[model samples]
Target: MSGVGKSTVLRELGLRGLEVVDTDDPGWIEVVDGEPLWRLPRVTSLLDRPRDRPVVVQGTVANQGALYHRFDAVVLLTAPRAVVLQRIRSRTTNSYGKAPAELARIEQDLRDVEPLLRAGATHVVDTSAPLPEVVLAVERIARGA
Candidate 1:
């Protein structure tokens, strides 16, 4: 999610009239409704009693099979390792993880998450191109527009 621009694409879709659910924000935590909740257990309760809405959920977290099963589709974004490293470098100047080890750890996380992408994700977006291109790809995948 950090390197992938999932939220950016989702926001673009929202602008085009697609209702979206961004679980990356903490506020989503307050809205859980049902059983077999989202990967975040609290979200399960939210699902049990969901509000009247058409939404696409997006986030990166461990153990999300529950949400994965519930969603009509899942989008996983990935970019070339060098591009991702550059993105992290350019965008995270003010972050606490500015040191070499921290950056290395972030790259490691990306590598470690690769298997999960292969195993669980339904659609994978290769985000090595421009943002608009990535958003366009996701829009096609999610909105078919």
Candidate 2:
């Protein structure tokens, strides 16, 4: 989930004049033992912001039950294991799943956590597609298509 292009899609949306927030932004993330954790209150505060357009908040923190009802729509972005691994290797912003232990944890999440998130998602998009296409899909979902 860390490398599923959530941030990239949010950036594309921002360029197209949409309001967006990536929860992984500085001050909203806390690293614990080299693994990133969401600063829940900060994230909730950001989500509470008023916006004229649909504000897209992207992250893998959707599993937090308390935050579920706050979202009008939940879009889960998924990719195959190979693609996820590749993206993780290429990413430079955060060192997620880089170490052996983290990689194992990420693998476990792929098998366990992702499906639970998927079950609760209002919409699901495959990130193996082109970035623009993925952004378009997210936009459509955000607009309640």
Candidate 3:
């Protein structure tokens, strides 16, 4: 997760006033102003409000239907299986007593999301690029800048 540029891009955008949400933050599951609420009702309710504002949510693609309709665009970051495995190995802090199995699960998750992306929820930005390049690409998309 650290090797991926999700947090990087989201932070950059947030610094520019975009309301950024990273589901990896435990607080995301709690109700709080300006923080992400993972529950469908809360997220949808926030989306329904009228505002001349921007929001960037970087979350694992698991249980995605909860926020699917809430977003105007979805940027699914894709990386090769081996690349992701390497990333996990280098970055995950706790192995949960089964590193190999956890790596397998991550690979499976990437495979599963490929279809949703193919079906076209929105844009899919490949994070395999260099960090700056990836950030620039996401910025351009975020602002149409």
Top candidate on TM-score is 2
Question: RMSD per prediction, one decimal?
Answer: 5.2, 2.8, 5.3
Q: Lowest-lDDT window of 10 residues in candidate 2? A: 58-67
Model 3 vs truth, CA RMSD: 5.3
- Please provide the root mean square deviation of candidate 1 (C-alpha atoms, Å): 5.2
Clashes of each: 12, 0, 0
Off by over 4 Å in 3: 1-3, 27-37, 49-52, 61-63, 92-98
For model 2, how does the per-residue alpha-carbon lDDT over 1-145 read when each residue is reduced to its tens digit? 7677777888898887778877766776777777666777886887787777887887765335567788888888999999999999888987877999998978988999999989988889999999989999998877767
* Candidate 1 residue-pair clash tally: 12
Q: State the displacement of the C-alpha of residue 58, model 2, in Å, after optimal TM-score superposition.
A: 1.7
What lDDT tens digits, residue by residue, belong to model 3 across residues 25-83?
76446544754346655556657777666667676534566667767676766666666
Give lDDT for model 1. Answer: 0.67
lDDT of 1 at 26: 64
Candidate order (TM-score): 2, 1, 3
Q: Write the per-residue lDDT of candidate 1 for residues 1-145, one digit (tens) a residue.
A: 4655665677887886667777766654332443222346556665566555446677666557657776667778887778776776676433523678887766777778676765798888888877788777776766544
Candidate 2 vs 3: which has more lDDT: 2
